[model samples]
Target chain A: MWKSVIYKEWLKTRWFLIIYAAIGVLAVGRIFLKVQHDFTFNEATNFWYVILFQGYQYFGILKFLPALGGLIIAVSQFFPETVNKRIKLTFHLPIVENKVMIIMMLFGACCLLLTFGVVSLFFYGLSIIYFPHEIIHGALVTMTPWFLAGLAIYFLAALIILEPVWKFRFLYALVAVAFIPSVFFDDTITGGYSPANPVLFVLVIIMSTALLFSGYRFRKGEM
Target chain B: MVRLSRYFLVIIAIIAFSVVIPKFYWMAFEKPVRSPFVMYSCVENDFMIQKSTQDGLVRTDTRGNNYTREQYEEKLPLMYMRQLMISGTMPDTINGVFMDAREINDERSTFRLRTRDLFTPDPGLYPMFESQSGRANLEMPDDYFRITWRMEFVDANTNKILEEKSRMFSAVLYNRGFDFPAKSINGIPTTRKSIDEGYLVIDSEDQLFHVKMIKGKPFVEKVEIPEGLKFKHISCVDFRNKRYYAYLFSEENDLYILTQDDYVLKKLPVDGLIPEEQEIKIYADYFHYNIISDGEGYMRSQILDADFNPVDEYSETWPVKMERTEGKIYKFLFPGELSLSNSNSNYNAFFLNLNKSINWLVLSLILIVIQFFIIKRRNEKFKNQIVDFTAILFTGIFGFLAVNIFPNKFFK
Candidate 1:
C-alpha cells in the first residue's frame, strides 16, 4: 500500500523534481564558481579574512530553494486530487484513512530531504576546498533552518490544499505563512540559530503533525 | 472536533497577529531615538554635550549655553590636545596640570561598557590567543576552548578536541579555585594591537580569573574580587594605554576598574546607572578621568581625579520625539493587547508586556459592533458571534482583521 502511495506521489512530482534538482545544482555550483573566481582574481587573504571575521555568508542563495521545492511538491501532489474530488477515493482506500494521509506526507517530506541532502553534500565538498572544517560545519549548521523550513512548508501546503472549504484553506495559509517565516528570524552568517535550533526543530516537527488534524477534517466532510 | 479546530485556528491567528501586526507597524513607523554624546571638560569643569539637530550641529553646556565648535574643542583640551598641538592652539595649562599632546596621547585611556538583558545567552566558548609568544606581534590561536565542567580546546583547523591541553587548563583553573563551569566569560582577542593581554573570566562563584595561552601553555592567574561585590557586567579593555585590564560593573550599578596590577580592583566613585539601558563612555588623560553615562533623553557626566575622587558633575534632560510617539501609540491602540514579544534578545521566545489602554477598548468595541452586524446578517449562531466578539475585544485591531479576512466556516 505504501509502495502504491509512493508511486502515485512520484507520478505527480517526477517532472517538477527534475527541475528542482537542476536548480539546486546550478545555484550551489554558481556560488562555488563565484567564490573560486574571487580567490583566483582577488586577494585570497582578504577573502579568507572576510569569511572568518566579517561574517561573509557563501550559502545565503540556497536558503529559500528548499522551501520553494516543498511548496511546489505539495501543490503537485494534492491540487489535482482536490480539483477532481479524487482525494476522497484515496481517503476511502482499504487502509486506515489517516495512515494513508501520513504516508503521502512522509513521501513528500522524504523527497524534499533527498533534494536538500544532495545539494548540501555538494556544498560541503565545495566549502572544504576553499575554507577549513570549522567554517564548513558552521555553514552547514546555519543551513539546517532553511531545510527545516522546506519540510514545514511542504506539510503546511499539503494541509492547506487538502481542505475542501475556501474559508478554512485561507485561514490555514495565513497561519502557515506566519509560522513558516519565523524559522528565518535569525539569518546571521554564524551561530545565529545555534541557541534556539533544538527547541525550534521540535516545534516544527510537532507543527507538522497538524496535517493529520486537517486531514481528519477533510475526511469528515466538515465543509 | 469542528469546534476544536475553530479554537486551534483562532489561537494560531492570535499568536500570528501578535508577532506579525506589531512587527509590520514598527517597521513602517519606528525611528531611531538617540541621546547626544556627553563628554566632561576638565578645563571648563563642566559637561560638553554634542548633538546634531534640524538647525545644525549644536554644542552646549548643561545650562543651555551654546558654544562654537572651536570653543567646545578648547573646553576639552585634554581630549583635543593632539589637535590643539597640531593646530598651534594649545592651552598652557588645564586644572594646574601642564598640557603636553605627546604625553597625553601616550597615557590617555578610554573604555566603554555595556550590559545586555538577562535573557541573552552567551556563546559558551572562547578563543584564547597566545599573549606572550616571545615575538613582537600577537597572533591568533589555532584552537578555541569550550567550558562545560572543564575547558576543552578544539582545533579550529581539523575540528579535533585537544584532550591533553584541555586536561592541563582544567587542572590549573581548578587549582586556582575557579568553579569548573564558568557562569559568565568575556574575552577580547589581541589581534588588534602589538601587545596581548589575554582574557578575563568570571566563574560561578563570581570570582575573576585571567587566562591566556603563553608559548603553547596555559597561563592562569587569579584576580582578587572585592568581597560582597556582586559583579553584573564585564567589558574587557584592550587600550593602547595598558593602564587597566578591564572595567567591571556591579549589580548595584557601581563601576570598578580592574587595574593592570593583576590583584587590585579600583572602585570608581560613580553611581546612579542602569548598565543595560545606558551608554557609558569614559575618557581618561594624565590628570583627570571623565565618565559620561547617557540614557534615553538624559545625560549625566562626572569628572574624577586620578584616584577616582569626584572633581565635578553635571546632568541634563531633553524632549525625545520617537520614544514619546511610540509611547503614545502604544497607549492608544494596544491596551490589553497580549503580545508575545522577544523584546531584548534575538531569540523568538514568548514574553508578555501587559498594559491597559482605554483607547484600545473603544477601538475594539467599534470593531466588534461592526462584526456583530455582519454575523447577524449571516444568521450565525449566538456562540459563534460571541467568540468573534471576545477575540476582537482581547486582540483589538488584529482580531478584527483576522476574523474579517478569514471568516469562520461554521457561521455559514
Candidate 2:
C-alpha cells in the first residue's frame, strides 16, 4: 500500500523534479562559471583577497535554489490533492487514515531529499574545480541551512495542504512566511550559523510529523 | 501521536512569533541615535565630544564648553592634522614638542578589532608579500600559504600546492623551532598598505613566531611570550613608526604590543575595555596616546604618556537605543527575542535575550484576558482552555499568539 502511495507521489512530481534538477545544475554551474570568469578577469591574488577578506560569496547563488526546489516539490505534490477533495479519496484506501497521508508525505520528502542530495553533490564537484578545500568547506557550512530549508518547506507545505480548514491553512502559511526566511540569513558571513545548524535540522524533523495533526483533523472532518 | 504533532507546530510557531514580533516592531519604530565621537585632547587635558546634528558637526568639551571649527581643530591638533595642514594654521610644535606632518603620519595608526573578525570562518589562506621588496608599492604575491602539518603555499592561479616553496618555507619554520600544525595565523594581507609586516602565527605548541618573506628568503623571528599568558588575538601591524611588530590581546583582557626595541612585549595599562564588544581607538602622537573604547551606550577614554603609562581617564554615557521609549515599548510587547546577531557580531547563532523589565508582564496579562474572551466567545468550556492560558502565562505573548493560531479542541 505504501509502495502504491509512493508511486502516486512520484507520478505527480516527476516532471517538476526533472526540471528542478536541470535548474539546480544550471544554478551551480553558473556559479563556478562566474568564478572562472572572475579568475580570468582579475588578478588571482586580488581575487582571493576579495573573497577571503571582503567576504565574497561565490556559491551564494545556490542559496535560494534549494528553497525553491522544496517549494516546487511541495506545490506539485500536494496542491492538486486539495482540489475537488482528492485527498479524501486517497485516505479511503485500505491503509489507515494517518498512514496513507504519512506515506504520501514521506514520499514527497524522499523525493526532495534525493533531489537536494544530488544538487549538493553537484555543488561539491563544481566547488572544488576552482576553489581550495578551505573555500569549499566554507561554502558547505554556509549552504547547510539552505538545504535544510528545502526539507522544512516540504514538511510545512504538506502540513498546510493536508489540513481540512482554510483558516488553518492561512495560519500555517503565515507562520511559514515568518519561519522560512529566518533560515536564509541575509549576510555573507561564512559558517555564521554553525551553532544553529543542528537545531534547524531538528526543526525539519519536527515539521515532518506535522502532517499527522492535519491528517487527523481532516479524517475527523474538521471543516 | 496527533497531539504530539500539534505540539511540534506550536513550538515552531512560538519561535517564529518571537523573532517576527520584535523584528517588525523595531522596523516600524526604530530611530537612529547618533553616538558622539569621543576622544581625548592632550592640549586641554580633557575628553572632546564631536556630535553630528541638523546644522553641522557640533564640537564641545566634556565640561559643556563649545568651540568654533577653527578653535576645535586647534584643540585636538593630532586629530585634525590634515585640516590644519590644509588651512596653513598648523602649529610648529604642540606641547613644546617639535612636530611635522611626516613625523605625525608615522606615529598615527589605528588598531580596530571587532567581534565579527574573530568569530567568522577563517579562509585559511594568506598571501606572503616581500616585506622589503624595494618597490614603489606593495605588490601581491602569486601564491597563498596555509599552515597545517607544515607551511604549504598554493598557487593562486592554479589552486595547486607548490611543493618546492612549501618545503623551503617549512624548513625555515622547522629550523626556528616552530611546531607543526599552526594554531592561529594572523596578518593584514591586503596590498593597500605601504609596507608589509608579514604574519604573526601561533604554532601548535602555542609558541609565537613572526614569519616574513624578504628578498626571496624566509625571515622567521621567534617571539618569547610571557609565561602563563594566553593570547586571544595577535595581528602584525605595519606602522611606519617602526615601533611595534604586532598588537597582542590577551585572554585576560589586556592589550600588549611586541615592540621593535628588542622584541619586548609591553602590557599596556588599560582598564574597562572589552575588545569584543567595543570600538577601540588608539590615537597616538608625540605627546600622548589616547586609548578610547566606545561601547554600546558609553565611551571610556584613557590618556597614556609615550611610555604607555596611564595618566588621566574619562567616562561618559548617553541613552542607547534600547533605553529610549521605543525600546521600552518593545520590552512591554516582547518578553524575549530570538536574534541571530547583535550590534558588534554577525555570527548566525541562536541568541536569546529575554526582557528583564517587570513591565513585560503587562502584555502577558492582557493577552491572557484576550484569550479568555476568545474562548468564551467561541462557546468553549473554561476547563478545556487551561493549557492555552497556562502557555500564555508562561511563554508570554509568543505562546499566546501560537495557541490562538493553532486551535486546541477537546471533548467535554
Stretches > 4 Å off in candidate 2: B52-57, B379-385, B410-412
DockQ (Cα-based) per candidate?
0.22, 0.69
Cα lDDT tens digits, model 2, B253-299, are 89899987487888999877677888777778766887788888888
TM-scores for candidates 1 onward, in order: 0.82, 0.95
Report residue B369 deviation for candidate 1 (angstroms). 1.0
TM-score of chain B, per candidate? Answer: 0.89, 0.92
Interface RMSD of each: 5.2, 1.8
Candidate 2 — which pairs collide? none
Candidate 1 per-residue C-alpha lDDT over A87-174 given as tens digits, one digit per residue, 9 for 90 to 100: 8889877898767877887888888889889998889877776665556766776777888888778877887888778887887788
Candidate 1 residue lDDT tens string, B1-412: 4444445545555656766766676677777655777787777667788888887789998778899988899888778876777877887877677766677787688776543333443445456777777877765666667777898886654456789999999999999898968877776743776576777888888888988777778888998776877788878777666778888888888888888855578888888877777767888877788888877678788889877888988787876533478756866676443232344443334445555446678888988888888887878776856777898898887788666654665545
